[model samples]
Target chain A: MRRNLAIVPAFNEADSIAPTVAAIYQWAPDFDVLVVDDGSTDATAHRASKAGATVLRMPFNLGIGGAMQGGYIYALEHDYEVAVQVDGDGQHDPRHIYELLDHLREDPELNMVTGSRFLASSGQGFQSSAARRAGIRIFSSLVSLITGQRVTDPTSGFRMTNRRGIELFARDYPHDYPEVEAILLIHAHRLRSCEIPVLMQPRLTGASAISSTQSVYYMVKVLLAVFVGLFRRRPIEAGDRPAMAVEHAL
Target chain B: MTKITLQRGLAIAVTLGLLLLVFELVRRKRLSERYAILWLVAATTLFVLAVWKGLLTSLSHDVGISYPPSALFAVAIGLIAMILLHFSLAVSRLSDQNKVLAQRLGLLAQRLEKAEERSADARAAPVPGKRSALPDHSEAEAEAPVPAQELSTRR
Candidate 1:
C-alpha cells in the first residue's frame, strides 16, 4: 500500500520535459508520475504525455506554487502515500529521488525531505548565478533563524512530502516565492524535515524565469512573505489532529 | 455666478453624477450591489458637504484649516484613498480564488484524460461475439488516457 507519486511541475519546458520524464521513469519505475503542465504554449503537455507521464494541463499559468498545490491535491485525492516534487526543467537529478524517499521512509516522524545542493558534502557542483547565490544565502539564514533548522538551500524546488505535509499544503500554500515560505510553513505545522546533499544540473533550456534585475524585487518580496508568515495565524489546529499510523520502516 | 457657487455647484454635480453612475451600473448588472454600497456612501458624503456650505466652513475652521474650500479637497482625497484600499482588498481576494480555480482545473483535467484513455483501450479490441463495450470512438477517447507511449516511440 506504499503508493508513491512524483509531481513534476513544468512551465513551457518542451525541450527538457521528455528527457526529464524519461529520467524519472528510468530512475524510479515504481512511482506514478504526474506532470502539472503550467499553461505552456509550447508542446509541453503533448511531449510529457508522449513521455509516458500523466499530464495535468492548466488552462492558464498559475506559477510554481499553484501548480505544485494542484499536484498535492491530486496526491491527496488519489490516496498517494508519498508525493515527491521534481522540477521539469531537468535541473534536479531524479537519481537522487530515491535518497529523498529513503530519508522519508527511514523516519516516520519526518514529514518532508528537501534536496539541497549546498548541504555539507553535497559536492557543490553547480552554484547558481552570484546574485541568486547571495539571495539564497540570506533567505537560508532568515529561515534558519525563525525555524531553528539550518536550511542550506531554501530555494530548492526538489522536495518530498508525506500525507501530513500534503494535506497541510493542499489546504493553504504560498502563491509567490513558495519554496522558502513552504519550509517555514512545514515548521509552523510542527512537522519534522531533513535535507540531504543532491546535485543540481544547469537548466537544459530557457533562462531562469527570475531575471537579474528582478533579483532585488525577488529578495524583498520573499523577505516580506517570510516575515508575514511568522505573524499569520497557524492554519492547522494542533489539538484536533488524528494520530498518524506509526510504522517502523518502509 | 460667484466663485463659491461655481466651485460648490460643480462639486455637487460631480457627486450626483457618481451616485447616478453607480445606480446605473447596478441596474445593468455590471456592478455588484455589495460594491455599490462603497460608491453610494462616498457620493452621499460628498453631496452633503457640497450642499451644506456652512458645515464645510465650520468643520475646516474647527480643524484649524484656514481655507474652507481646501477641506472639501482634503475629504475627497481621503475618501478616494479609502476606496482604493477597498479595491486592493477585492483584487487580492479575487486572485486567491483564481489560483484555487486554476488548481482545481488542472486536477480535473488530468482525471478526464485518464478516463478517456481507459475507454479508448476497451474499444481498440472486440471479443468475437460480444459488442465493443464502447461503440463511440470519441467517447472512448474521452475515457482513455492520452497515448503517451506512442509519442515516446516517435523520438
Candidate 2:
C-alpha cells in the first residue's frame, strides 16, 4: 500500500488552507493530506477539512514545530508508510510533489527527502527573498558542519519522510525551528536524507510572523540544540531497532 | 618595625584574597569551577603585579617593554575579555535550553489537556470498541466545508 500522507502545519491560514489543499489534491491525488492545525483562531482547520484534508486541531497554539510533531505522532500511530511535509501558507506548489514522490519511489533507503529551493538542477525552483536566502545559507552551514554533510536549504518546510523518519521524529523532533533542526535530528539518528529541487509560490495569506529577531532566535536555538545533543544520554541509533511508541507516555 | 616583611605579607594577602574571591564565586555558583582556574590565574596575576611593581618592572625590562604596568594591565584585560566571552557562550546555551524546556512544558500541557478530554468523554458515555474516548474537536471553523447535501440548488 502506498500510504503516503502530506502533513501541512498551518496556523491562522484561513485564506490559504482551501486553495493549498485543493492544489495538493490536483498535484498528488494518491497522497493523503493531513493538516495539523496549530490551534488557529481563524478557520484554518475547517477550511482545510472542507477542502478534503484530515484536520488534527491541537488543543492550543504549539507553533510550527509542535504542529508538525503532532502530524508525525499521527503518522506513527496510524502506521503511515510515508509522510511528507508541505507548508500551509500556499507556498509549496503541488506540482513539485511529484518530483519529491519520485525520489521515494526510486529508493527505499532514502528515509527523508526535502524539497530544496536552492537545489534546482534546472535553475527553475522557487526564488526566495534576499534575507531568507541569507538565513538559509547560514543555517545550512551550521547543519553541514554538524551533520558532516552539505544541506542547501536547512529551513525548507517541504520535506518527505518514510516510516522510519516519521517514527524517529515522532519520538524526538526539535521543539523549535524544527524544519532546520530536523536535518540535524535525522542525521544524529543516522538516517539518509536527500534534497531535490521543487517549485514554491509566495505566501498567500496574512503577514509573516518570522521577523529578523525571530530568525536570530531560530538560529541560536537550533545551534544550541545541536550543541546540547552532544551531551544527551543514550542517543538513538538507526536500524531495525524497536520503535519507540511514545504516544501514551507523551 | 615593618620593612619588606609586611610588604611581602601584603603581597601574599592580596594574592590569597583574589583566590578567596574565586573560591567564593565557585562556592556560590556565580562561576563554574572548571573556568575558575582561569579566573584564579587572572586575579592572582593582577594582584601580584599590583603589589610587586619592582619585580614586574625588572622582568618587563628583561622582556624589553618600556611601560611594564600598561603591559601587565593589558594582559589582565585580555584574560578578562576571554573569560567574558566564554561566559557569554554559556549564557547563550542556557537561554535556548530554557526555551526548549518551555516548549516541552507546553507539549506536556497539551498532553494533559488531551488526557482530560479523553477522561471526560469516557465518563460521559460508555460503549463498546467503536470510537476513541477523546473528543473530536475540529480546529478550524466556518470556512470548513459543510455537508454537500441538503437541497443546495441555490448558490
Candidate 3:
C-alpha cells in the first residue's frame, strides 16, 4: 500500500485535537496522522502527542497556509505517496479519507481529490450558513469559470493530493483564504482535480476563524487573490521533472 | 529682508540636520548603507535647493508652482513616499523569509525528535550480536541528555 499521511493543522484546539487524532487513527489505521500545532497557546501539541499522532510545533502562528505548507514539506521530505488534509476542529470526517484516496488512485490524471459537502443531493450533512454558502457559490462559479472545470465546493478543505499536488502546494500557497485559490493553482499548473461527496459536521469546539463580520472582507480578499493569481507565471513543464529536481535541491 | 534671510537660515539648518542624522545613523550602524543611500540623496537634494534660492524659485516656476517653498515641500513628500514604499517592500520580503524560517524550524525540530526517539529505542533494546564499540559510544551519549541545541546548529 502507498504511504498515506493526514496533515491536521490545529490552532488552539486542545479540546478537540485528541479526539480528532484518535478518530483518524481509528478510521485510517494504515495512514499516519501528523498534527501541526500552529503556535497554540493551549495544550494542543501535548494532547495530539498523547493521542499518538506525530506533532510538529511551529515557533509562531503562520496561519493555515504556512501550517499546511509545513505538513506538505514534511510529506515531501518523507516521500509520502499520498497526503490528506483534515481540519483539526473535527468538522472533517476521517472515514471519508479513504473515499478521497480511492478517487485519486482510480484516476491516473487527477492530481487532487477534494471532498465536497454540496455534491450530494440529499444534503445529509452540515451545509454552511446561507451567507457563507453564497460566498462559496460565488467562489465555486468563479473557479469553475476560470479553470473550465466543475467545482461544486471550492472552499472544501477536506482534500487529498498526490505527489504532484503536494509539490505545487509546498512550493507556493496563498497565505490566507487558500482553499478556493488552490483549485486555480492546480489548474494553472495544468494539473487535474475533482470532488467527491462527503458528510461534514459543524465545528466541535471554538468559533470559526471567519465570522459573519469578516465574511465580506474574506470574500473580497479571496476574489482578489484569485484574480491576481491569473497573472502569475506557470513554471512547470509538461513532464514535471523540473519541479522534481527543484524539490530535490531543496 | 531679514525675514527672508531667517527663512533661508532655517531651511539650510533643517536640511543639514537631516543629512547629519542620516550620516550618524549609518555610522552608528542603526541603518544599513543600502537604505542610507536614499536618505542621503534626499537630504542632499533638499540642501542644494535650500542653499540655492534662485534655483528653487526658477525650478518652482518651471514646474508651474507660484510658491517656491511648496515645491520643496512637494519634493520632500515625494521622497518620503518613495522611502515608505521601499520599507513596505522590505517588510513584505522579511515576512516571507520569516514564514519559511518558521516552517523549516518546525520540520527540523520534528526530525530531531524522531531521531532522538529512535536512538532511545535502540538503547532500550540493544541487539545482542549487533552490539559493538560504536553502539557503546552511542549508548554513553544517549545516557546523557541529547544535545539538541548542538545538533540543530550543526544542521
Candidate 4:
C-alpha cells in the first residue's frame, strides 16, 4: 500500500486552516494530513487539530522553508511513500493533490510533480499581483534554462514529492525563496520533475508574506540563490555518480 | 620633551587604558579569553609602537612620509581595521550558530509535543489484560526527531 502524507505549512491562517483541513479530509481521506503550525500567533494550531489534522507546532516562525523542511523530515522519518505540500491559506485546492499524486504514481521515473496555476488550458483563478507574476515568470525562465525543463510555476508551493525527493529535501533545503531553487536542487540531485495544470483559488484570509513592494527584492534574491546553485555539485552518492551525472548533466 | 613626545605620551596613556579595559573585561568574564586575546594583542602592539619613537621615525623615513606621527596614525588605523574585520568574521559565525540553535529549538519543541501526545493517548486508551493500546510509547519518544532546515553546508 502506498502511504501518502499531506504536509500543510501554516503561519497565522487561523481563519482558513479549518476549512482547508476539512477539504483535505473530504477530498483525500487516504492521505494523512499534518499541519505544521509555524509558530502562529493565532489559533491556527488549535483549529487545525479540531479539524482532525495532526498539528506540529513549531516553537517559533521558521518561515515557509523551515516549516516545509520540518514536514519533509517528518515524512522521511515516518517512512511515508510520498509527501504532498499544501498551502494553509486555501489557495491550493486539495482536489488537485490527487492529480499530482496520479503523475507520481503512474511514473516511477518522476521524483516530484508540481501544480502550475498559469497553464494556458487551465482556467484562470487568482494569479497574484502583476509584479509577483512578473517575478514568477523570471524564476520560471531561469529554472527552465538550468534544468532544460519548461516550468510554468516555479514558485508554486502545491507540489508532491516521492520518498527520494522527500529525503533529499529533508537533508538540505533552501532557507529563503525555496520554490524556484528547489527545482534547481532537485535537478542537481538528479531527480526527475514534472508539472501539472491546477487552478489556484483566491487566498482565504491574511495577506501574502511577500508584499507588492518586496516582489522586486524577492526576484533579485531568488535569482542570486539560483545562480549560486548553478556552481553547486550534485548531492548524489559517490558510487552512483556516473549514471546520475550522465542523466542530468547540462 | 618635544611636542612629538607629548603626543606620544598621550597615545601611550590611551593604549594603557585600553589594555587595562581588556584585562578587566576578561577578569569579569564579560569577554571570553578567545576574543580578549585579539584585543590584548592589538593594545600591546599599539603600546610598544607608541613607546618605540625611534622605530616610528625610521619606519616613516623608509615609507617616504614627511611626518613620523603620521606613520603612527597609519599603523593604528591599519591595525584597528584588521581587528574590526576579524570581529566581523566572528560575528558572522555567531549569527550562523544562532540560526542553527533557533531551528533546533523549534524541532525539539515539536518532538516534545509529540511525546506528550503519545503518553496522553496511552494513558487515555482502554487497556485490556495489562496491555496498553500504545505499547511502544517509550520507543516513540526515543525516536521522536524532526529536522528543521537544510543542514548541509552551502558550496
Query: Model 2, residue A90: what's the lDDT?
Result: 84
Best by TM-score: 3
List clashing residue pairs in candidate 1. Answer: B115-B143, B115-B144, B116-B142, B116-B143, B116-B144, B117-B143, B117-B144, B117-B145, B118-B144
Instruction: Order the numbered candidates by lDDT, best leading.
Output: 3, 1, 4, 2
- Per-residue C-alpha lDDT of model 1 across residues B1-155, encoded as one tens digit per residue: 33567888898899889989999999999999998898888888888998888899899999999988799889988988998999998887787777777777777777787678765865675566333454543444566655898758655
> Just chain B of model 3: what TM-score?
0.79
Candidate 1 local lDDT, A1-250, one digit each (tens): 2279999999999999999999999998878888999899999999999998888888899988888887887777776888999999899999998999999999999999999999746456677977778889999899889889788899998999989998877766777678998998899888988899998999999988787777777788888988777786874332222212111011
Candidate 1 vs 3: which has more DockQ = 3
CAPRI tier for the interface of model 2 = incorrect
Interface RMSD of 2: 12.7
Query: Which candidate has the highest lDDT of all?
Result: 3
> What is the Å distance of residue A5 in model 2 from its true position?
0.9
Question: Highest DockQ: which candidate?
Answer: 3
Off-target runs (Cα >4 Å) in candidate 2 are: A121-125, A231-250, B1-155
lDDT of 2 at A138: 82
Show pairs that collide, candidate 4: none
DockQ values of all predictions:
0.35, 0.03, 0.38, 0.19
Interface RMSD of 4: 9.1
Judged by DockQ relative to the true structure, which candidate is superior, 1 or 4? 1
Candidate 2, pairs of clashing residues: A46-B140, A46-B144
The lDDT of model 4 is 0.81
